[model samples]
Target chain A: MSSHDHHHDHNHDHEHPRLSELQLRVKALESLLVDKGLVDPAALDVFIDTYETKVGPRNGAQVVAKAWADPKFKAALLADASAAIKSFGFEGRQGEHMVVLENTPKVHNMVVCTLCSCYPWPVLGLPPVWYKSAPYRARAVNDPRGVLADFGTELPGDIEIKVWDSTAELRYLVLPMRPAGTDHLSEDELADLITRNSMIGTEIVTFPAKAQEAAE
Target chain B: MNGAHDMGGMHGFGPVLQEKDEPWFHGEWEKKAFALTLACGGLGQWNIDISRHARENQPPAQYLDNSYYEQWLHGLEVLLVEAGLVTEDELKTGKANGKSNVAALPADRVFKALQQGSPYAREIAEAPAFKPGDKVRVKSMNPPGHTRAPQYVRGHVGEIVMHHGAHVFADASARGEHGVAHHIYNVAFTAEELWGADGQGGAVHLDLWEPYLERAR
Candidate 1:
């Protein structure tokens, strides 16, 4: 979703010491690896580029759009998410075991790794800094509605909020409800309307026209 | 090891540090740490679980103080030493004393390996203990080692909604041991059950292993 807003969190202010020492430790480890030739610098560069530039939230958006369009695919996705996602070549790493939670008009779904930053890497790529931050991890489970509100997503009191706590063994991906008045739009355009936060359950996917109307 | 990494339901780390335009890798060192960790992982010396334990098992004070990537770097060192890829002396001195046994990841293969990521699922013949729609209580034992069960869920009852065939148990897998496959389930817990009636009442769904639960009386 949005960056974890921590202005009101007073506990964090007194915790977490300086980091200059950690920087030196990382530097030492890298130098050792380079000297040993165990890790080629060029290869390391390729690794970083692959994750940062190649894999991303766009992959998850495509899956969501396809599910919205095809009922069969949606059933298959909810049945066995790992296989359905792997069919799209989004398999591996933090996403080994996936469970897709469908969001309906009565129920909303959100995800947070309470223990650690266990996110679906192949589909959503690496998690945003906020997903891994201390406050979001602690509060997402305790105050999901409040967390969603911070992201500017307000739901009716009647709709139930369902928060999923991700773990190393399994990862959760939220399939958000489709926005109305865009039945004629192509799948590509529908995918465009989906934001990373929408799939994370903090925000909902609204059509461009609707977003503009709300802005006005 | 009940380390700081277990943040569920704990208070006081302020709002998520939102970035308007957050660039990957806040600095070059973070990039190096990320790449190096991936490169070392490519050697097949350890599984993802081990890497997680290395990070999670850190001394509480150190774990809380370090940044995210800094934790990654710290975990990498633990793996290198435990896997015998490097010695503590080498890490401290930043020197390679002898010829290496582990082959470096070739640049050309880096992209391919990343694309063809390894899957952690394994085949298990034993039937699952609990079934969907069954009421169960999360085991309350305070394990001395790494665990996926959170502090809040232990002893609380929930309903099993789905079964994810079989996968490696992270508790054992984190020690570099595999084949301890167990059925995983999506257990649904009510908001009021987890944090009393004062909480914003709703539901919380968690992917829990069969071992973490017992039939609720």
Candidate 2:
């Protein structure tokens, strides 16, 4: 049978040897801890549950939202991104020397870690699967606009899109243009405007009203 | 061995795995591990001994079971704990205290400041090593580890279009052992020049590094 046929047949099924092995190891490790009385299985379960719900890109979204609302703050962000970002109390590994690129009418910005998926995790959280995917890493540098199109982002033909590849030395975070109709909104409301996908340049942030209208 | 980023032409094996759709805590430990590795390198305490051994002798199946990030985290933990930068107890305490101990700057503020052209003033002020009209060729070297020079671009000649100031080197093999300041360059190449007339684009631009180029004859 052809590969395409095989793929269609298994459309709903997926196999991950690595994940299975990991699950097995996790169980084994948990049992070991329980047997040694070092930790309780229930406690471990609680910890895992809390971590899953509480830890994520929401903090990054808040930072992106604040930048969208304040111009001087945006200026500070552009001038010394690392220090400015620190003012909000977010900092770290991939974030050591963070640089923020603004997407404007004249020019747009997209970031990629062409070498081994170097991303600003502390702010952006874990990169989307596509960010680390081989197709993205390879095509983004060569055909940025085309790739953006695939992601449902199509810039005006006149506008220029500058693709920035993050390296070990400096990391990048994209500041997407704030959607219109978001004025008069509170900081928390604005923070709600930001999405992790927007920060990564995959999707544009939409105002809730506009989004709701569209959905309707 | 191949560079870490060179995964092109290897797609047909299986379906794409969407990491977001997976359970939230699935890769939490793994992400911590990956950050620790980067932190160790940032703090100047990276040791490749274990990595080299792992790559050479190959660890047990259990070791391979964890995601790449998990392995990286374990490696970082081993190195940092051994070096006394962090103790296991401290790590646990920090975890209990809520959030990993790594420091971070706010994302939005950083973006705003950089847009105002105030952050990289000193670095930007320094004149570019090469100008827009200068002709340069990508350097030819088969160094181990990750490099910005895509295999297709090696030995190809291009012209400097713009000069982005000094940036960090992407080659982990070089920077992992010794600190080096690598600069980024915007080099433009005609499609015909790199891939002949059949190449789709009229001209291709590459943001290459200084070491990736030499003066074109």
Candidate 3:
């Protein structure tokens, strides 16, 4: 099955003619729930808006940047991730308990929920489709390097790839190492250098072009 | 339930497809599915563990065929029916037989509800069974209900790296009971220990609760 495409050739018992079967099913379910006073449609709107627009990896980037800029915060983040993260007002839902894995020269950390799509929703937002897909869930633990390679990341032979399988309530986020030649940049600029994948550990933070020039 | 959801270390699936700048919801239906699940969950009829079990309890063939959101939608339907809030006939007919007594989660409360998420960590009077640096084996048992222990580490020995205080036990929670509190730990397993010759030169860490573990023999 193609993980990217939602379209499948399942035999439908009934058809809407215009809408897909799944779409029609959801609409019917929603209408039924609303009619029964089981769920508020307005509340559903808020739920969608929260994840779709509000919370995302930018929150994680700022956390990483603060840790990079302030050693005290870094120590606190490493020590108690939940409280340190809550200082930024980004704790709730799937991210009640948190752990930050620091990637260093000797070790690279990657997070995966082998059982289901358990992610740090407060910091990193909802997991990307690839992270939740069967292939990733199956391979990440047994073949960390291979999974990294799929994400276009290749580490040195010596760097130990630590695969964190989030099997319980504690959520994990990778604190990617700051790239070289980024010391001159401000924390905000440093946050700009961090990508969603970087904090996810599939990609490493890299020196921006301006920072590279400034270093020289 | 040893189902398709326990996919770690398995094979035959294709490469991990990474979409550039992937959106939160792939389709409008997915958004509805996600929101509906969370909103219905707020009704307090079922816990997250029960919800998870609903998703994982599907037949392997059916579970593997459905998308992530498809699975969520399926699970939500199952929960609604099991809770007596809805019926299969009502779902098919697209009509509610009667109104629900539970108040719907209001729009204004959605933000606070999400921001202050339901925490699973529980206070237990008992001390942790094992300490850091202690070796333990994941018990090899196929539980008929919900469990957080993954299949790959099931019979493997690992060292406890850190002890996370007591948390809700998922297996008990799936049965709609207030879960039994168990001390959780971060167990570290070498790649070689998990996958014999196919093992990569790395390590895997899993957050395991007390019930899933025993002293390594």
Q: Supply DockQ values for each candidate.
A: 0.52, 0.11, 0.52
lDDT of 3 at B143: 87
Which parts of model 3 are misplaced by more than 4 Å?
A1-19, A209-216
Ranking by TM-score: 3, 1, 2
Question: Across all candidates, what is each one's fraction of true contacts kept?
Answer: 0.70, 0.06, 0.88
Docking class of 2: incorrect
lDDT of each residue in B24-138, candidate 3, tens digit only: 7867898999999999999989999999999999999999988888899999999999998998999999988889888899999999999889898899999888999999999
* Local accuracy by lDDT, each model: 0.81, 0.54, 0.88
Docking class of 3: medium
Error of 2 at A175 (Å): 1.3
Q: Which model is ahead, 1 or 3, in terms of lDDT?
A: 3
- For candidate 1, list the clashing residue pairs, or say none: A3-B18, A4-B15, A4-B16, A5-B15, A6-B15, B1-B145
lDDT of 2 by residue, B73-141 (tens): 455545545655555764443332233244322223333322232121124344556777788887777
Off by over 4 Å in 1: A1-24, A209-216
How far off is residue A147 in model 3, in Å? 0.5
